[model samples]
Target: MRIRLLGGLEVTSPDDRQVRFTTRKTSLLFAALVLAGRRGHRRDQLSELFWPGRADGQARNSLRQALVDIRRSFPPGEHATTYIDGDQDSVALIVDPDQTDISIFDLKLQSDRPSDLAIAADLYRGEMLAGEALADGMDEWFGPHQNKYEQKAQQLVERLSLALSQPGSPEETACEGLAERLLASDPTAEAAHRALMRIHTLRGHENAALRQFELCKALLKRHLGAEPEAQTTALAASLQAGKAGDLPLTAPKANAATGPKPPAPSVSTPLHDRPSVAVLPFQNLSGDPEQEYFADGIVEDITIALAQFRHLYVIARNSSFTYKGKAVDIKQVGRELGVRYVVEGSVRRTGDRLRIAGQLIDASTGAHLWADRFDGTLADVFDLQDQVAASIVGAITPKVEEAEIERAKRKPTESLDAYDYYLRGLAAFDRTITNRSSLEEALRLFMQAIERDPEFAVAYARAARCYATRKSNGWMIDRAQETGEATRLARRAVELGWDDAIALSYGGYVLGYVSGDLDASAACIERALVLNPHLAAAVGVSSWIKICSGEPEAAIEHASLAMRLSPFDPRLFAWQFNVGLAHFCAGRYDEAAAWAGKSMRHQPNYPSAMRVAAAGLAKAGRIAEAREMVARLCAFDPTLRISNLAEILPPFRRPDDRDRYIEALRIGGLPD
Candidate 1:
């Protein structure tokens, strides 16, 4: 007998004669038994599975009748024992897995050989049992199986797309067919769309490739209400620019002398130094199937929270949720997802009480680094979820950082990619206390990162920030040239990083300070805060923008909130300076001077901190000390006189605020 279950249930005799089951239940039961292998399923379990909510004796009778019906479907006089075997306790199908198409497909998928994978691709004709009439509640049991096969098929096509990247290869056409089948199964499969785009581009069908990109974009927006990911967008852009061949789907074969080595498996060698993580769907232990939505919501919240961190590489929720309802090995998941960490959790509810438990695992080693449980009432479920997400992110961030630090130690500088260069630039930027040398190095490094990947938005923003620092310290030799360059970089950052909070934060600050565009700057900063309310840098920048706009109270409140979010933030000096400036604007001279003193202790030579200290001290009648601050500020930057103060400082929105600041500096004996 030959059994096929890919498109639908079909059985044939050795003479190619069609065989039909008397009832749909008998066919489903036969498929179930065949999938159960030689060990078979317990009669009680099968009864509960197929005839749920029925009495034990009645369900057993139904199962027996179904077995009889299945046996009768076979050739008569061939004996029921030939295909079906049972001895009261349980039942078995005497068919080898290799004899069935679905099982054969799975076995072929297990092999790493491309030829075997191609055959596996051919066997998955469509969704498993695509048009079979499942029982009313049978979908719950069947959905996972169908989804699992579909996910495997998607992976198979992507692997084949990368493997058969060459033009005019025989398998390339087969891979295209598999890609289309994947789209038929799931119209929202971006990977399938990307594969088709690349295949078309390789076959010199540029227009076809561009059309596929538009289709992917429309489908994503319609179904997900989101834009395509950065990778997909970059691929589409390359295709549009007629540089499709420059962005190969697979790495070129490496030669000993000149060619680059093949990508590694650590967090997908393409991401280079980035450490990726995935949060699997939290299991619903509440016994009520309805709570599945609650469990999924928790995972989604956690995934979004984790993605807010600029340095973390988080896998999308759609990809992570594919592991739902499966018993997965952590190592295998890590390898398949290209993530170093995996987060899994469970939600259990009893009465009005809720318990959410989560664990962070080092996927490479299967070691649990952190685990915690939160208890709350359903009335406060939203707050409970927020607490869970914050706890998980706060716990795992440091662990990920430690791992990345160690990885950086072992990585060669020659192999540094865009992300690595960006990280190095960030480190240099953080160490730039009052020296132009460190700031210069940070700018160069950031520019290098941008050169390596021109679409890197945050790198552009940070590089613009370096120019902002130079302007603040009076280090620019040619103000017009530097201002124009900073504006260009800042605008590019804003254009490219519409959805990135960190990029928006820094880019907004530079544009406001250097280009005097307060309205546009405020818009970008406000959007960044909306995107990630917990981002301390965005909060800090918003506070500075408020101060520039002469809203001292709002500025002070935002600065305080930023400090609370990151009390020991690397940019603590900047936060303190913002608070001081806000207090100065509010005419609280004593408090302003005190806060400015605190900022100076962190960065003594920062010209703005010195100016704020002098202005506050003079307004509070500390004559000698105020004059000393003025002298120190001038020693740092001789050109910073009251005459040119309007040109040097950030453009103030209120004339009264600017005049008051200048009057205070004049009282401190600044040069005319």
Candidate 2:
């Protein structure tokens, strides 16, 4: 019999008749034995692994029955018994190791010969046990095996792509197929994408190669919100310049006779904690020499506005303006300025009409991230300049952050520095779900960031927010310790980052919520707003502070402004929740419930949204729906009680506001 277990379990008799097990467990057990080869599993171990907590006798009997089922799977009189032999203590599948596809795959991989490696590359149909439904504990058992095989497949594809670099050789064709397969399985496989680009270029299909680069860029952006790596970008640039013929496909790999080869040369790129951007002086499209000053003024204003954001590194006006009135390469400008992003534009005037157009491009890949134009009359030139500057700053800040977050996500965890870890923590914390585990992970990463750089103010600020998240979700254990930690982190953040608007905003919010220090929180957030009024997060937190301070109108207005500032921000749900809370405080129960529903749609498990929806619904006389929301709330926080509201919730500045919220929740059917 021939059995294959690489992709999924498959059994074929000597006569080529297909054989399948009726029970999934039996098939899994059989596959396990096949992987085990001659030295099989002990019966007791197999029994407990598959049928946990069962009586010893019952588990042993089940194992025996499974073995019998495996034996009967083959054709009658084929003596399948010889293939499966074991003493009472252990079960073993005795078959020629070569008969199994996995063994042949391993054997071929060991051979330094290119042909054997090619065969090994073709043998990986997919991840081990592909499409096979694994039982709960079984996945834990199989996970290591799956990871090992997946890594092996990745190695094989990369090795083949490097070893077989000839233009039209059979080995090259096989490498192309393998790279394609790897990409199909993992769209974020940059190595595979690079391999395909090299392959297409070697085949004299330059356009196809360029298209492959575009595909890779889109895939990275769509899935990871990141740009291509520097080396990949360089390859694409070389291809565009028609110099790909001189490019080596890869660093050498182990040859049939030679040993392992040297590593590829590293590409040089600047390392910055925050993404850097340069706003080049806009070209004066108008024929009038007076229009040159207009373009320059607008670019200068934009550079200043962008510099206000703490997370961005905006190039100085003098440096950027040196390229004024000259045609410049975006990539060269980026390299010279040590920036990841470049903003270029043109200003045109036709009689009294003014039109200014701008585009944001990734400096490394030359990919345009955003583009837009504004039209107005030059009647109020300064007003138009301010409007356009604000518009550009607002539009590109979020885009830059998105790209940076994606790049951080793609960085190897083993090599991460403080800033990379902080970015990763930010991404995890921004998840709409707001789950406990994700919050925990965000906290862990932020603490790691702090460990790498003790004075990382923003990291401390975000780490405090993670505790606030846990408290909001009712995931906090050992309340005093967590509360103390959160307060310390917040205080340290504010102390260290007095000039950083983002740090102050995040830290202030955490302090206000956890420590109930409304005055200090308000002062910090107000300072942050003054520092960077266009910052959506600062604005959002300011709105929450307003809600706590009993200024419902100001709260709603700030929340609205925050939303308008970054319409696509991941924290939109929080702003929506803030609006709901302000309306609830203003006693608009129905409207509050509606807004809470909207927030829940964006972030389904947001604890504040759930509470607001339940209380507002009950106040609006929607008892049935209110009870349903309460049921979900209780499921999410099983320990929640009306009596301990102050422990879990932030204190309202007005005592009546707190009492009103408590009364509403009590009426909503929350358990005492």
Candidate 3:
């Protein structure tokens, strides 16, 4: 029989048919035995897990019965000893060490080398026993182990991300797919998000990068009742602002916004120009910390919805959230956030009614440009959010003709309720990264949103991206099914919302990562950019693809363009890393070293940066520095050997280029 654990739990007989257990608990028992490795649980422990809260006699009887059923099913003499029961010790899965998928997953994860990542990703089936029941005793017993697997999945994703980020490799397509899977399994996983964002951005899908921020914001709001973690938010902001190069790796001081604000409105500033704006965390005027999420959600939704407008250069949710619960002068806030206009608000909820008061401030003069109060029933909450965003958009950009405002007000697809669910789904998806349960919750919310609005192209695109990412990252078991679903949904997104930059970028990114059609990927990303030049996702993805396709010079240029557009973006590491990779591919060892050094400066222990730096040092004949860098790489991933390095690298379009990179690493002393 073959056991699969990536998608749903499935045991197949030799004939290739699924083997169904009488109860899910039995499957759980088997899974536990397999995951436990050689050391199995004793009878008493098994009883507690299988029949918790029961009397000792009853629990023992239950364990005995379970064993009897398992034995009968196995028919010891006829069946292979997949399960072995000991007299007084424990029960274990009996198999050759190399036969089991779980063993393979463990071996890959335990390896300190980056090459094992691909194998690990392929072995993932799905969320462990995805549709299995976790009632009564099984919940406690399996919960911790599930958590452990989820964490391992995340680690493997990081390893693959590092590998794919290297220069001169064809593995990027596969790695990109794996990263997508990882994100699907844990949408809010910072590493997964960062990896996907980097890949998409390089492929010239800057809008996709921005969508990543949206997803992150949605997940955070749903789960934490808060914004994304500071680092993640900053990363997204940096990408959106096209300032990925300028963003610092460490979290900026929470007490103060990071950089200077955009120039104030003046004679030089066009009247029709919507001075970009950022909505900082509103003061909780109601004196209830519990209401903070509502207040923050209001800001986030407005920010996201407004950002969709082609004319508006709204700051990403991350940079805006830096001011959460902090006090600051409006001019200082504007200056630090790099926006000429600022929107500040307060939320007061009373029973079934909510009172939201907001103002648009001219950062240059600290004058109130527009102020309004929205008083309504709880059901009208989302409408109030729309009104607030629309008002702010109109106030800051006086030339924004009424028609333009109306155009901006156009609902995603005439389904306000679906939009609401989409917002809520985004919230859940953003917070799903810390654990498996959260990921499932996020998926549930996304599915709920999709059901409410089947034609919601952005929603479909995001869902597809999520599932594809989950499979790619080894966070799920059934890679083929998840990716297949992603492909279908992404194609649907294009059919439904061809004009939506986000949909195009996200859908195109999924296509490129999973299917390796460079032409299609390029076309989709280019279309997204033409529709929204300021869309950071489009810019980032385009740059990534250029580098992977052996046009490192173009990659650097694209990254530069993205940085200029979104200067305060928080995800600078991605841009810088791409720049470094491009330089490495172009054989600019010195420049590559500098860029890699810059990346390390931002994210000190970033594995990709470390490898890039090592490669640069090796190419430059700085043997000592190269060796030191390799040592660091090895310490981070001990299983990294020269043979595996070549295997993990993305295929180089040029044989000479590939040979050069491999030789550099070999000289730098990668083992074997």
Candidate 4:
């Protein structure tokens, strides 16, 4: 018998018959244990996570009934212990390596080979436990695992795409096949789309390459209200203009968007260097004509923020808004505005909450650049407006910057060995994922970078950033000494690279987060934004300050915007924490608890998230659940105390807020 949890719950009998449980709670119980992987959960833990509303005795009784249902779905025998095993204390699913697809997928991902990655991609049928609606409580336990599997799938897509881009790889067809399957699930996946284009060009199928470009371009524009990045455009040009005798095999592969694509020899470049964008007024979907003002307000805010980007030419509001209430073609809008991108959306206000959905499109090809939805209480409608603006600007700038960075990296590496060290540091830094060992390794690489190039301000900023990370995570080895050192490095970064956005932003972060100088930090970040308004990290830091400084609403707006700006950013979980903190500070305990759940869902091992969630749940009147969260938090970090929270927390501008925070944590059962 085989257990399946990849798409949905199912058991394959030896006779090839499919067996599935009808009880939703039973399925959740089965999933909880299997997704736990090796760490078996105590029966009590499972009971509470799935049935928190029930009393302890009732919850345990419910768990017993679910377990009965789960066992009945499996093949008959004492083989019951072979599939599911548990004592009175704990329970878990034992994976049969040969029969389980996830085990094979996981094992294959451990290898760096492209073939292995492609094999793993084939096993991920869809979202984990797909087609099943997860209740609120189950999500806190199961969501992170689901995201991890999805991330693994994405990594596979990236590797296979890279393989297809290689000139003489024997697995081009196989890699393309796997990539297409992945794209079938997420059509807007830029890497997979690019891979298909590369595959066609490699085979000398010019028409296929052109068609793939149009398909990608059309989808991106139609869904996102934006266009393909310049790199994609230039690559399409390369495919089309290739001589009948020769093709460019080295179309830039999937990479962290940092730089630009080299234009094809026969193609003419755009007159301007920046991406041009027009912000169209959002449609009033609230069914109330009075909400038209709110919709228009969101568009205006987005326009202003986008106009701040030096690398993006934004159409004036007067021009963009002329098409209001008119069903103008996106392509026509693009031509009229002389812009490459157009932003559009709809707003619906239901009761006390407004839900806003927005998309960025390529005006010429109708390719979607980005799309997302924002939901929040109407009390903070202005904050919601800012979030929409931040999201759109965030979506467009990174890809352009990434292409530029890649181009810079592609230069001969011998003369630029210092930069090589810096690149290695960045790779290591990304691996940190808020872990101690990886962070230390990244710092070592950054140190080597500056040793080779004494003038590398970005390296200094990154080095200083290590201390700030430690500060954020409460991992400071020696608080005062680390803060002083971080300040020294930050000051050096500001002096050495006034124009470098990375240097300024990271430097500003250290100053604000560690050195406790908000004003100075603000100046550095402000200057960095002037240099590159699209620096998502800098915007997030700004939000952090607002959150701790008694401006919860502002912090949430900025944090949410920062998240939308770079959705795949590794540090996004940390930013989500800020959003939760902001809601908690604003006395929106329910919202705070919900966002806290989101942070933990993104990073299940994140300890701070437990604390925030506990505090919120306690304040929200879910005492039993809050106590449970506190127990988990203390198990993760035994030394945490309610009284000492101020040591880890930034000095709040409001004393009352500080008192409330501490009291809530205490009520949630934190020490002292």
**Model 1, residue 249: displacement in angstroms?**
38
List, residue by residue over 169-188, the lDDT tens digit for candidate 2: 77677667777777888896
* Deviating ranges (above 4 Å) for candidate 4: 1-435, 448-459, 605-607, 614-634, 640-644, 663-672
lDDT of 3 by residue, 1-672 (tens): 677766567676545666776666777777777677666666667777787889968988877776776665554555564656566535665655565676687777656455676777767655676777788667666765666566566656655654554433444555566667766776657657766665666666778877877886777556434455444555676677786543323233342345543333343432223437777776554435676777777777667655765445678878777566443556566666666777787776656666776766656545444455667776776676665554444343332222233333464645446555555555554432324465566566667768877888888877776764454323555656766777888888878867877788878877776655556777888888877565665687788778767888899998877665443343466678789878989989978878887776544556667778888889998999899998987876666777756423544466666777778878888878
Top candidate on lDDT is: 2
What is the lDDT of every predicted structure here?
A: 0.79, 0.80, 0.65, 0.72
Clashes of each: 0, 0, 86, 28
TM-score of 4: 0.52
Runs in model 3 lying further than 4 Å from the true structure: 1-448, 463-486, 600-607, 623-652, 655-659, 662-672
Q: What lDDT is obtained when candidate 1 is compared to the true structure?
A: 0.79
Per-candidate TM vs. native? 0.52, 0.60, 0.37, 0.52
Clashing pairs in 1: none
Candidate 1, superposed: residue stretches over 4 Å from native: 1-273, 280-298, 308-312, 318-333, 342-381, 387-409, 601-604
lDDT per residue (tens digit) for residues 1-672 in model 4: 676777666667655778666688777777777766655677777887888888979999998888777666553365443356678867776656666777787788666677776677667777788878888877767776776666566545555654554555655756676667667777866656776776777776778878988998888666654456444565676666664233333233322452332222253324243457788878775556777888888888778776665445777888776666543456556665677778888786667878887776656655444566789888998887777667666765654344334433676756656666676677666654457788888888888889998998988999998877776566776778988999999999989878777788888878877788878888888788776666687778778778767899889888877786888676688789889989999999988888887787666647667777988999999999999998987876666787567766666778888888889889998889
| lDDT at position 127, candidate 1 | 87
Would you give me the overall lDDT of model 3?
0.65
Candidate 2 Cα errors over 4 Å, as ranges: 1-273, 284-294, 347-356, 373-384
